[model samples]
Structure formats: structure tokens, C-alpha cells
Target: MEHPSNGLSIIGCLRPAFYDEESYLRGLFHNEDGDGYASDWKDGERLNFNSQSAGANICSTLYKLEIMRMELFSVYGVQSSISLQHFQDAEPDVLVHSSSEIIERFNEKGMKSNAALKSLCRKKGLNVEGANIIGVDSLGMDVRVFSGAESQTLRFSFKSRVTSGRAAEKKIQQMLFPRIQRKKFKAHDEGLKNLDSF
Candidate 1:
């Protein structure tokens, strides 16, 4: 069993309660052996790793410590592939390929943020490729990223209020809900040279 208060190794998405192949990658990177482990065939004939808490395990602490929190209230909203901007100066013209515009924009801008956001994102290792800053609203800012691929997003909510410094880490940890760790398989030895240790 993992010690209490340790963070997750498996990456999880709250909007879509699911785990994919990438979870394994998260497992290998965390604990070398403690958290990641292979199970017997009876245990679903698969390796085993830890699971994330269903929801925020330390929300109270977060609220108290993080003066402001950027909760991703919603995400991954997709629209129809067709857009009027893509067509020529007339109607029913060739539909524009969504990806073409993304490439074009990247050419104009380096696909990076200004000095401020860039510094913050770098501290968090954010991938801001193919992003567009539309406008600012009550939600701080309206932005989009990754025109076609697995378009990821980021929302920053900063209230002037003050919170406990200690709580900030846990708040971000649970919200991000980072990737989990996995263990390796114990294969049979090629030779029977040593039963002596046993």
C-alpha cells in the first residue's frame, strides 16, 4: 500500500472518467517499484498501478491555502468542423481544412505566450502550441489551443485574496491530478544457477 498523502502517478481526466494507455507512462516515471507492480494472471492478467481519488481529497485545504484557484469549470467543447471563414468570398465554396489555418497562425507567431504567461507555463511545463487568445471575460481570459489534435486548454483564476502558502501545492496537485506509476514484471531467470539464496 502507498503511504498516505502521496500524489498519484496515473494521469486522469475529470470531465471524462477514463484511463488510457498513457497511464502506464505516468506509472513508470514515479516510484521505481513501490507504487508500480505487476500482478498475477488471476489479477486480470495485467499489471497494476494506483488509482486517483474520485474528487478533490483536500479541497478544504485548497480553499484555505490557495487565495485564488483556477478551476477548469468546463473543457473540451468541440464544434462542427465547418466554419464560414474557411470558404472563399462566396458560399458553398471548398470547405477549409481546419488544420491549414492552425499551421498558418503558427508561422506568424511562434506559438508561445508573452513573457509573463510563458514564465508561468514553463514552471508548469504547459504545451501552448496552436493556441489563440480570443478575448477576456469574467473568466479571466478566453483562449483556445490545438485546432485539430487533442486540443488542451488552460484557465487561470487569480483572486486578490490571500491563502496559506502550504495549501497551494496540494490544490494544484489535485486539480492537475498528475499521472500515476506502474510496476514491472518479474520474468523467469534464463538459467537455474542459483537456488542457493532461497
Candidate 2:
């Protein structure tokens, strides 16, 4: 899949004809028995060496799968191929450019801000100490939780849909700081009532 803002392409085969195909490819590029492996990508102007680090690899794989799942399946179970223009025409829940900032904000607040996320983590026996947001959309976000040497991705859904980055930010803020937002809303309502009384 290609990012609209950047010309960079993420190439991966989601399904292999044979089950062993994935293991074979992984062996070639990520062999624990070997001296490790390296992958490179070049776009004429720049050559980038892809790291085989555990965190990097997991993030890349999760991102690819998430994008594919969102693009291929409209409502999770249903699958359909969609055109790039059509996908673009439908406003994405979270804008690509704003994703980084949103993720950063969520990280800064830590897991304490989101009770649902914290509860889910506890139910799954995941350690929220080093957890972080890897991917997010209007529906929810993919959080990476670490436990010892292992890591897993957890999907945390939002209460409602967000069409733009601003909306997503507001939704996240409301989720993260419910009491503050409620007070702000209450104050605004009171101010409006006062104006009406005048």
C-alpha cells in the first residue's frame, strides 16, 4: 500500500499460497539462528535500510495489517476491494499528518487517562507500564503492550466516530480528561444560559 502524502510504498504479501511461505520469507529476512537480516528500500533519490529490531518489525507488521484490514473490509467481517480514489474520497477517521501528534499526546497522558483501555489491559493481563499507541483510526486505536520480552497489540475502540484530525483530538481529549471536558461544557452551557437571561 502507498501513502497518499508520501510516495513510499509498503510491500508485503498478506496471504501466501502455502502456509510455509510466510515462515520461509521470515527465515530469509528475520532468522534468529542466522546473523540477522537487513532489508532496503530505494526510490531513486533515497535509500533506506529497514531495521529488523523487534519493536520496529512488530510496528511495521501491525501497521500493514491494520491498513489492509481497514482498506479491504468496510465493516470488519465484510470484504471488498476499493479504489484509491474512492477510499480517498471517503474522509478517513484520522488524517495521516495528524496521527503523529495525536499519538504523542496520548502517550504523554499515559494509560491512566483511559479507563476502558486500562481495564482492557488488566483483563488481558497486559502490563501497561510501557504500552504505547501504534495506530489509530476513527473507530479505535492499536496499542502495543509489553510484558517481559514479548509484546502484543490491543484494539481499543472509541465511543463514537471521528471524521477529521480535530474531531479525533477532541474525542481523545474527552476520553482522556472526561471531568475537565465536562466542566468546560458545563461552564459554556451556563454562560449561554446567562446570555439568554440577559
Candidate 3:
């Protein structure tokens, strides 16, 4: 669902209990006549899909969320480290806007040979041929890997939290080109030391 105030899109499955109810009650937040629980939600639209495909998509989304939750727990020692308010209030547009560029750069950097991807493939014992970054956020990204007749979703965490898409892009660049990033970091450090001498 898209936030009424900010336009950040969040996708998740509605509970089965609300499946047969009106869209607004099912958390759609909008309806005809501009009068509903979320009257301010003006442009909410629902798309119907086959049960099988929808179920698969929901499963994939849930899996990704689970992985993210685990990562958060490991990092923050609490499941609710990031509250709902964070998502509601945070500016995700920058990250959303730069996702395509990040994906392109990742693919262009020879995704199949990425050490992280290779590690996942080896750990899972799967022969993945091609991989694509399907989604990215401040914390991490979800990558879709394709084998001969199977596919898998893998999660890669960022070294540090990024607020903007450009920052996320830089993080991915650092991951893909560690040597270049290290050299840049070294040069930056030298410059800082030179300034300290002044």
C-alpha cells in the first residue's frame, strides 16, 4: 500500500480474515466518494491476480521481510529496533528513485561473479547462472538468482546504513569495487592528515 502523505509504497499480504471485506477495511485506505477510514488516501488501486501467483509473490515478500528481520535482530538485538514510525516517517524516495541505477551498476559489474553471490551459491549448492537485484533499501538488498529450473532469493546487508539512493549506490559500488574504494579512502585519509599538519 502507498502512504497517503508520502507516496512510499509498501507491499505486504493482507490477513485472510480481511480478504472478503471492503478494500478500505482490508487496509486499502481509500474508496469511492472520498469517505473511508483513510479518506485522504485518494488514489489507492487494487490489482487482482491468480491465487497461485499471488501466493508465490506474497511468500517471496514474506521471506525477504523475514530475512531483513533476522538481520535487524542480529545487528540491533531487538526485533522492534526499527519501529513502524520509522517507515511511516522516513524519506525513502531517494532510495526508491536510485534503485534502478543501483541495479544496473550491480548487473554491469558482473553479478554472477560477485563474491557474495558466489558464496551464497556455494553454501546453497546451486549453480546460479544469472542474478539481478530485485529490491534495495537502507539496510540491504534482495537479489534474485536463477538456476536451470529453480530460482532463489538472497539478502545482502550494507556495511552501513544509507539514507539516500546515491549513498546506497556508493555502498554497492564499494562492495563491487573494494580495491577502488580502498584507494579512495586512503587518499581521503592522506588529505585529512595533510590538513591536520596545517
Best by lDDT: 2
lDDT of 3 by residue, 1-198 (tens): 110111222335443222333443434433444432222222233223222332353211111121122113322123334455565576745577777777777767674436545555556576676666666778887766766776656667888789887888777665644676568768999999999999
Q: Measured by TM-score, how close is model 3 to the native structure?
A: 0.40
Q: Pick out the ten consecutive residues of candidate 2 with the lowest summed lDDT.
A: 1-10
Positional deviation of 155 in candidate 2, in angstroms?
0.9
Model 1 stretches with alpha carbons more than 4 Å out: 1-118, 161-198
Clashing pairs in model 3? Answer: none
The list of candidate 2 runs beyond 4 A from truth reads: 1-94, 110-120, 123-128, 174-198
- lDDT (10s digit) by residue, model 1, range 23-45: 55445434545543322222432
What TM-score does each of the candidates earn? 0.22, 0.40, 0.40
Clashing pairs in 2: none
Give the C-alpha miss distance for residue 53 in model 2, angstroms. 41
Q: Better model by lDDT, 1 or 2?
A: 2
What C-alpha lDDT values do all the predictions have? Answer: 0.33, 0.55, 0.54
Model 3 global lDDT (CA atoms, 0 to 1): 0.54
Off by over 4 Å in 3: 1-93, 109-127, 180-198
